[model samples]
Target chain A: MHLLVCGGTGCRASASDSIVESLKQELENKGLSDEVQVIMTGCFGFCEKGPIVKVLPDNTFYVEVKHEDAVEIVDEHVIKGRQVKRLLYQDPEKKQSISDSKHMDFYKKQIRIALRNCGFIDPENVDEYIGRDGYMALGKCINEMTPQDVIKEIKDSGLRGRGGGGFPTGLKWEIASKNNADQKYVVCNADEGDPGAFMDRSILEGDPHAVLEAMAICGYATNASKGLIYIRAEYPLAIKRLKIAIDQAREYGLLGKNIFGSDFEFDVELRYGAGAFVCGEETALIHSMEGLRGEPTIKPPYPAEKGYLGKPTNVNNVETFANIPVIINKGANWFNKIGTEKSKGTKVFALAGKINNVGLIEVPMGTTLREVIFEIGGGIKDGKKFKAVQTGGPSGGCLTEKHLDTPIDFDNLIAAGSMMGSGGMIVMDEDDCMVSVAKFYLDFTVEESCGKCSPCRIGNKRLYELLDQITQGKATMDDLQRLRNMCEVIKDTSLCGLGQTSPNPILSTLDNFWDEYVAHIKDHKCPAGQCKDLMKYVVIEENCVGCTACVRVCPVGAISGEKKQPHYIDPSNCIKCGACIERCKFDAIIVK
Target chain B: MSHIKVKIKEKDLNTIKQICKSFNNEPKELINVLHKTQEHFGYLPAEIQEVVAQELNVPVAKVYGVVTFYSFFTMLPKGKHPVSICTGTACYVRGADNVLQEFKRQLGIEVGETTEDGEFSLSCLRCVGACGLAPVVLVGDKTYGRVAPDGVKAIIDEYKK
Candidate 1:
C-alpha cells in the first residue's frame, strides 16, 4: 500500500510533516514498512479538510488526519485491511463517510486538466514525472512539428492565457514568432500577484516539470534559445522545486542545448520578483526581470514586439504554460472538445473565503458558478447566506447570486462585471459588507499602485478614500456619485492593465450591491455590520453572566462591572476589537 | 529608501561587493543583487545600498528606488524574528484584520515597525497561497495557520523565548 500525504503549503502549515513522520514510524512499528511506502505529494486541493492522507490500492481518502491518529491509521487500515471509518472524509451535507476520493462531490465535477499531475505525483522526482509521459510533448514538438505547426496546434486548441488577460496563448506565441529578433526570449510568469490565488504556486510545487517542458516548447515555437521564470520571492518552496526540476531536466538532456537531441536549444533561468503586484503585467514583468521598477509601459510595443532587453518575448503565466504540454499531447481537438466554444479546457481556481470547501479547484470552462459553489464547494460555511464571489483579485469585480447560474468562462466572467483574474474566487457571505469588501480591495490597489500613471496613482487613492468614507459611515450622497465617476476615470485613463482594471472592485461592487452602499450612505449603517465605525457593541442585559471575562479581555478597559454583575461597555472607549465579544461566555456582548 | 546612512562593517561591505560581482555587476540584475543583499543583511539600509550601487555602477538613487519599489526589501532592520500577517483576500475575509489588530495591540507597534527590544517586527504580505489555512502568520520561517484574534498573544509568546 502506498500512502500519499499532502505536502502542499496549506497541509504543511497544519503539521503535515509530523503526520508524515508518525505515519512512517507507525508503518515500521506494525512491521508493514516493506509493504507500505509513505510518499509526500503536492496539494490535493482539498485544503479545508487537510492534512489529507490517501491509502492507495483502495484509495481510502482520509481528511484532517492528525499525527496521533497515525497509529490507528496504520493499525486499522494497513495491517487488518479494515478502513479507518472515522478518518475517512465525512461528507459535510450527507454526513456519510466517503471511502474513495473519486466518489466525493468535490472531485466528481472537477476535470483536473491543469491540475492533472498535481496531488498525484511527487514533484521533486523527474523519473516519477517522466513515468507519466512528462517530457514527451516537448520531444514531439522538437522532433516532429515545425514552429508554425506547433503554433497552429495551439491556435486550434483555443487555449487563451489563463493569467487573467484571456489573450490567446497561440496568438501571443505567433506574434513573438513573427517578430524578427536575434535573441528572442520565452518568459514563464510564475509571479502570481492575485491576492487569493495559489494555483500557479501549487502547480510549480506539485508539477514543476510541466512548466519547464512547456517553456521549452514555447522556446522552440518562438525560436528563442533562452527562457526566464519570474517567480515571487514569497514562494520559497515553488522556487526550490523549480530549481530542482530545471537541474533534473538539464541532466536528462531535456532542457539545455539541443533538447531531446533536436537542433532546438532552450535553457531556463530564474528571476526573483520583489513584492510588486504590477509585475504580473507582461511589460511590468519584463521590466522587473530586467532589475528595474515593476512599472508597466504602453502596449504598442508589447512584450511580443519588444521585451526583456529589446528582444521578442512570449510571456505566459504558470497555469497558462501548464496547459501547453497537455494540449500538445492530447491534440487540440481533444482538448477543445471540453469547455465552451470560446474558452477551451479547464480553469483552475483557488476557491476560498466563506465557502465550506476552501481549496484549489479546476473545472471545465462552461461550469456554472452555482455548480462550483453549491455542488463542488459544498455551499457557504457556517450555513451563512451567500452574498458575493470576488474574482480577478484587485483588478476583477464581484459576482452576486444572480450571476451564480452564469457559466464561468473568461467572457462570461467579464460580462458579469468581473474578469477571470488569475482565478482567485473568494466567496463572501452575508456577514461580509459589500462596501467594506470594496474598501478592502481599494486598500490593496492603493498600496500596490506603481504611481507612474496619474489616473491609477491619484485616482485610485481618491477612490479608496471614498470607499473608506462610505465604510466608516462618513460619506454623503455626493461622495457616492463621486465614487462612481472616479472608477470610470481610473478605468479609462490608466496606463497599463493595472490602472485600467484597478477600479473593477468598486465598479463591480457598486453595480451589484447598490442597496448596501445606500444603507451605508442613507441609513448611515453598515448592512453587514462589518464596518467597525457603524457597529456598536451592546451589552445583552438578559444573557450577561458577569464572569469578568469580558472585563479582563477588553484591551482598552472598555468593559467594566462588579464581579458576577452585568458589565457595561464604554461606547467611547471601545475600539471594536471584538475581544469583549469573543470573551463573553454568556454571549452578553453583541454588535449592534 | 532611507536617506539616513548607517555605518556598515567592513565584512558586510565586502559581502555586498561580492554579491554584486557574482551577478557580473550588471545594471539589469539590480533586483537580484538587492535580494541577495537583503538575504545577507536582514534589511537594506542606505550604506549597503550605496555599496551595491557603487559595485553595480548604477546610481545610488536608482538602487534606493529599486529597493523602495519592492515591498520585499526592507529599509528598517527586522527584529530577531519577523512576524508577517497575510492580508490576502482569503485571509482578509476570514477575520485576518482582527488578528492583525490583536498583534498590533499586543506588540504595541504598527505594521512595518519593530519592537523596542528587537524581538519581533510586524508586516503584512499578500497571499502566501495557504488560503486553506486562512489567516496565516509567519514568525520568520514558521507558518501559523488559522490564527484568530485571541490566538495572537499566544503565537507571539511562542517566539518570546
Candidate 2:
C-alpha cells in the first residue's frame, strides 16, 4: 500500500510536511512501515481541498488532512483496512463523500496531458520520473531517429507553441536546424511573468525532468550543444528542483555528452530573470539571459538566424516542451486527433479569481469557457453572479458571459477579442467593475512597458489616465473615443508583443461592457460600486437604531447622531473607508 | 536611480568586487551580478551599483538604468520583516485591496516604504503561485493564507516585538 501526500507549495504552506512526517511515524508505531510506503508528490491541481492524501491500490482520496488526523488514518485506513469517512472529499453541493478523484467534478473534466505525472510522482527523485517513462523519448530520439525525422514527427503532430503566440514548434526547430552556426543553442522560456498565472511554475515544480528531457530532444533535433533555461528569480522552488533534476540527469549520463551511446552531446544551464514582465517576449528573454536590460529588438533576425551571442537558437516555453515526450511516445496521429482544428492539443490554465476551485487545471483545446468555469472550476465563488473571465494575462482581454459558450482556441479567442495568452483564466464576478478591471490591466502594462517604443510607453500611460478619470467620475464621453483610438495606435505601432496587445483589456471591455462605461460617464455612477470616488455613504433612517456604533468607528469623525436618534454621515469628511458600514449592526449604512 | 550620500565599509565593498571577479568581470553578467549582490545584501543601494559598474567597466548611468528598469531591483533597504501582499487577479477579487489598506494604515507607510523603526516594510508582489490561498500575505518567509482586513493588525503585531 502507498500513501501519496501532496508536497506542492500550497499544501506545504498548509503544513502537509508535518502531516507526512506524522503519517510516517504512526505507520512505524503500528509496524506497518514495511507494508505501507509514504511518498511526497507534487501539486494535485485540486488546491481548493489541498493537503490531499491518496491511498493507492484502493484509490481512497482524502481532502484537507490536518496534522492530528495522521494517527487516525493509520488506525482506521491502514491497519484495519477501513476508510476514514470524515477525511474523504465531500461534494459541496451533493454533500456526498467522494472516495476517488476520478469521479469528482474537478478531476473528471480535466484531461491531464501536461500534468500527467504532476501529482503521481516524486519530482526530486529522478528514478521515480524514469519509472513513468520520462527520458525514454530522449533515448528514442537519439537511437531510432535522425534530426530531420524528429522535426518531421513534430510537424506531423501539429504542435504549436504554447507561449501565447501559436507559432508552429516544428517550424521553429526547422528554422534553427537549417541555420549554419558553430555554436547553436536551445533556450527554454521559463520566465512566466503573467499575473495570476502559475502553469509553467507548477509544471517545473511538479515534473522538472520532463522539461530537461524535452530540451535534450530539442538539442538533438536542432543541432545545438548548449541549452539555457531563462527562468524567473521569484520561482526559487522551481529553480531548486530544476537544478536537482539537471544534476541528476547529468549524473545518470542522460544529459551530458553522447547520450544513448550516440555522437550527440548536449547540456543545459540556468539564467535568472530579474522580474521583468516584458522578458516573456522571446527577444527580450534572450537579451535578459545575456545579462542585458531585457529590451526587445525587432524580429526577422528572429533568434533562429542570430541569437544568444549571435548563434542560431530555438526557444520554447515550459508547457510546450512538456508535451513533446507525450507526442513522441504516443504517435503524431493519435496526439493530433484531440482538440480543435487549429489548436491540436491541450492547454494548461491557472484557473483563479472568484472561482470555486482555485487551482491549476489542464483541459483539451476547444473546451467551452462555460464547462471550464462551471463544471471544472465548480462555478463562481460565494455563488456570485458571473461577470467575465480574463484569459492570457494583461496582454489578453476580458470575455463576458456571452462569450462563455464560444470554444476556447487561438483563433476563436482572437475572434472574440481575446487571445489564448499563456492560459491565465481569471474569472471575475459581478463585484468587479469593467472600467476598473480595464484600468487594472492598464496599470500593469504601464509599469511593465520597456519604454522601447513611444506608442507603448506614452500611449499606455495615456490610456491609464483616461480609465482613472472614468473610475473617478471626471471623464467626459469624448475621453471614451480618445481611449478607443489610442488603443488602435498602440496596437499598430508598439515594438514588441507586450505593447501590441497591451490595449486588449480596454478594447475587449469596451466592446463587451459598453453599457457599464456609459453608466459611469453619463450618470457618474459605477454600477459595481468598486470605484471609491464615485461611492457615497448614507445612513438608512428607518434602519438606524441610533446605537452610536457608526459614530464610534468613523475614523475621520464623519458620522454624527444624537442619542437614540438617526445618524447622519457628512460625505466630504468621510474618507470612503467603509468603516461605518462594518460597525453598523442595524444595517443603517448604505453605499450608493 | 539617484544615489544617496552614505558611507560604505571596505569589507562590504570587497565582497561586491569579489562577486564581479567570479563572473569574469564580463559586461553581460551585469544582471546576474546584481541578482547575487541583492541576495547578499537585502537591497541594492547606490554604492553597490557604483562598485558593480566600476568592476564591469560599464557606466554608472547604465547600471542605474538597468536597476531602475526592472521592478525586482530595489534602491532602498528593506526592514527586518518584509511583508509582501499578493495583488494578483485572484487576490484582488477576494478583497486584497482592503487587506493592503489595513496593512498600510497599521504600518503608517505606503507599499514600498518601511516603518520608521525598520521593524516592518510593505510591498506588493504579482502572484506567489499560491492562488489557493488568495489574498495571501507573506512576512519574511512565513505565508499567511486567506488573510482578511481585520487580521492585518494581528499579523503586524506578531512581528512588532
Candidate 3:
C-alpha cells in the first residue's frame, strides 16, 4: 500500500511536509516502512480538506491531517489493517464518512485532463512522471510520427489555445513550419498574468515534464531546435520543478540534440518574466525577448511569420502545451469529443473569490458556470446569494445569474461579455458591489498598462478616474456615457491585448449592473454599502443596549454616545472602517 | 584596470555575467535573471535575453515570454522604489482614493508614473491581501497599512530617510 500525501504548495504551507515526514517516521517506528511506500504528490483539488493523506489500493481518503495523527494513521490502518473512520472526510450534507475521493461530490464531476498527474505523482521524481506515461508522447513523436504528422494530429484535435485568445494551436504550428526561416522558435507562455489564476503554475509544479515534453514535440514539429518556457518569477515552485524536469529530460535524452536516436534535434530553456501584463501579448513578448521595450507592435507579420530575432515562432501557454501530450496519446478524436465543437478539450480554472471550493479545476468546455460554481466549486461561500461570476480575470467581464446556464466556450463567453482569460473565474455574491467590481478590474488593467499606446495609456486613466469619481459619488449621468464611450475607444484603438480588453470590466458592469452605477450616481448611495465615501454608519437606538463593544473596537474613535444611550457615528470623523459593524453582536450599526 | 575606466568590451561580458550570476546556479533562475537584467536594462533586448538564456542554459524565447506575463516585474527599466497603493475593496472603502490623491498631490505624478529623477515610481494594486489594515502603501518591501491621507507625508519621509 502506498500513502500519497499532498505536497502541493498550499498544503505544504500548512505543515504537510512535517506530516509526511512524521508519517514516514511513524511507519519506520512501527517497522512498516518497507511494506508501505510514502509518496509526496501534487494538489488533490479538495484544498479545503488538505493536508490530505490518501492510502492507495483501497483508496482510503483522509482529510485535514496533522503531524500528531501520523501514528494513529499507521497504527490503526497500517498495522491493524483497519480504516480510520474518524480521519476520513465526512460528507458535509450527509455527515457520513467518505471512504474514497470518487465517492465525494467534489471529485464526482471533476474530469482532470491537464491536472491528471497532479495529486498522483511525486513531481520532483522523474521516474514517477515516466511511470504515468509522461515522456511517452515525446517518445511516440520522435520514434513514430514525422514533424508534419504531429502537426496534423494537433490540427485534427481542433485544440484552441487556452490562453484567452482561442487561437488554433495546430494552425499556429503549421504557420511556423511553413515559414522558411533559418532559425525558428517555440515559446511556452507560463506567464499566467491573470489574477486568481494558478492553473499554469500548478501544471508546471505537478507535471513539469508534460509541458517540457510537449515543448520538445512542438520544437520537433516546427523544426525548431530550441524551445523556451516563459514563466513568471512569482511561481517559485513551478520554476523549480520545471528546471528539474528540463535537466532530467536532457539526462534521459528526451531533450537536447538527437533525441531517442531520431534525426530530430530539440532542446528547451527557461525564461523568467518580471511581471508585465502587456508581455502576455505575443508581439510584446517577442519584442521583450528582442531586448527592446515590451511594447506591442502592430501585428501583420505575426510571431509565426517573423518573431524572436525575426524568425518564425509559435507560442502557446502552459495549459495549451499540457494538452498536447494527452492529445497525442489518446488520439485527436478522443480529445475532439470532450468539449464543444470549436473549443475542444478541458480547461483548467483557478476558481476563487466568494466560492466555497477555491482551488484549481479542469472541466469540459461546454460545462455551465452553474456546474463549475456549484458542482465543482462547491457553490458560493457563506451561503450568500449568487450575484454574478467574473471569468477571465481583468480582461474578462462579469456574468450575472441569467448567464449562469450559458455554456463556457470561447465563442459563448465572448458573446456573454466575458472571454476565457487564462481561466481565472472569480465568483461574486450579492454583498459585492458591481460598480466596485468593475472599478477593481479597471484598477488592475490601468496599472498593468504598458503605456505604449495612447488609448490604453490615456483612455484607461480617464476611465479609471471616472470610476473613481462614481465610486466617490462625484460623477453625473454624462460621466457614465463618457465612461462607455472611452471604453469603446480604448478597446478599438489599443495596440495590445492588455489595452484592447482593458475596458471589459467597465463594459460588462455597465451592461449588466447599470442600475448599481445609477444608484451610485443618482441616489448617491452604495446598495452593497461597499463605497465608503458614500456610506454612512449609524447605530440603531433600539438595538443598542449600552454595549461599549463597538466604541472600544472603533479604530478611528468615530463612535460616541453615553452608556446605554445608543452611539452615534460622526460622519466627518468616521473613516467607515467597518470595525464597529463587525464588532457589534446586536446588529446596532446600520450602514447606509 | 581602473574601477571606473573599464573597457567597453570587458564591461559587456561583465554585465552579462553580472546579470547571469544574479539568477544563481539554478537553471530555473532564468526568470529571476531576466527580471534583474530588465531591472538593469530598461527592457529585455534580444541580445541581452539571448545572453541570459545562454548563460543560464535556457532558451531566449522563454526569457522573452516570462518578461511579458506578470504585472509587477517590468521588462523595461523602471524607476526605483515602485510605490504601489492598495485600491482593493477594503482599501477603497477606507479612503484609498484620498491616499491616492495625496500621492498624486505630493509626487506631481499620477498612478503608474515615474518621477523625473527616476527615484519614485507609483502604481496601484488590486489588493495586497492586507485588507485588515486598508489603504496600504507598499514602498519597496515595507507595507504601511492603514495609511491615511495625512500619513502619506510621514510614510514618504521614512522612505526618504
Cα distance off (Å), candidate 1, residue A83: 1.6
Model 1 alpha-carbon drift over 4 Å, by segment: A29-32, A540-547, A563-566, B1-5
Give all TM-scores, in the order shown.
Answer: 0.98, 0.98, 0.84
Q: lDDT of model 2 at residue B60?
A: 87
lDDT of 1 by residue, A1-592 (tens): 7999999999998889899899999888878899998988899999999999988888889999999999998888888889989888888778999899999999999999888888888899999899999999998988889999999999999999999899999999999999998899999998888899999999999999999999999999999999999999999999999999999999999988777767788999999999999999999999999989999999889888989999889999999999999999999999999999899999999999999899999999999999999999999999999989998999999999999999999999888999998999999998999888888888998899999989999998899888888887888989888989888988889999998998898899889988899999888898888899998999998899778888887888888889878889899999998877777778878999
Tell me how large the interface RMSD of candidate 3 is. Answer: 7.4
Name the lDDT value of residue B108 in candidate 1: 95
Error of 2 at B99 (Å): 1.2
Tens digits of lDDT, candidate 3, A1-592? 8999987755665668899899999989888889999998877767656678999888999988999999999999988989989889887668899899898777887788899999899888888989999889888988899989999999999999998899999999998899987888999888766655667877888889889889888998998988988777656678888888888888988888778898778888876666666778888777655545567889888999988878888999989999999999999999999999889999988776677766678889899999998987778868888998888888889999999899999999999998998987777788788888888778777777888788998888889889999999999999999999989988999988888898999899999999999999999999887888998888888999867888897766888888878888889998776768778999988887
* Candidate 2 residue-wise lDDT, A1-592, digit = tens: 9999998888887889999999999989988899999998888988888889999889999999998999999999998899999999889889999999999999897888888899899889999999999899998999899999899999989899998999999999999999998899999999999988999998999999999999999999999999999998988889999999999999999999978888899999999988989999999988887777889999989999999988999999999999999998887898899899989889999999899998899999999999999999999989899999999899899998899999899999999999999989999999899899899889989989999899999999999999999998899999999999999999999999999999999999999999999989989999999999999999999999999988998867999989899989998898888878887888889999
What DockQ do the predictions score, one after another?
0.87, 0.76, 0.12
Q: What is the TM-score of chain B alone in each candidate?
A: 0.95, 0.96, 0.65
Which has the better DockQ: candidate 1, or candidate 3?
Answer: 1
Stretches > 4 Å off in candidate 2: none
Number of backbone collisions per candidate:
0, 0, 19
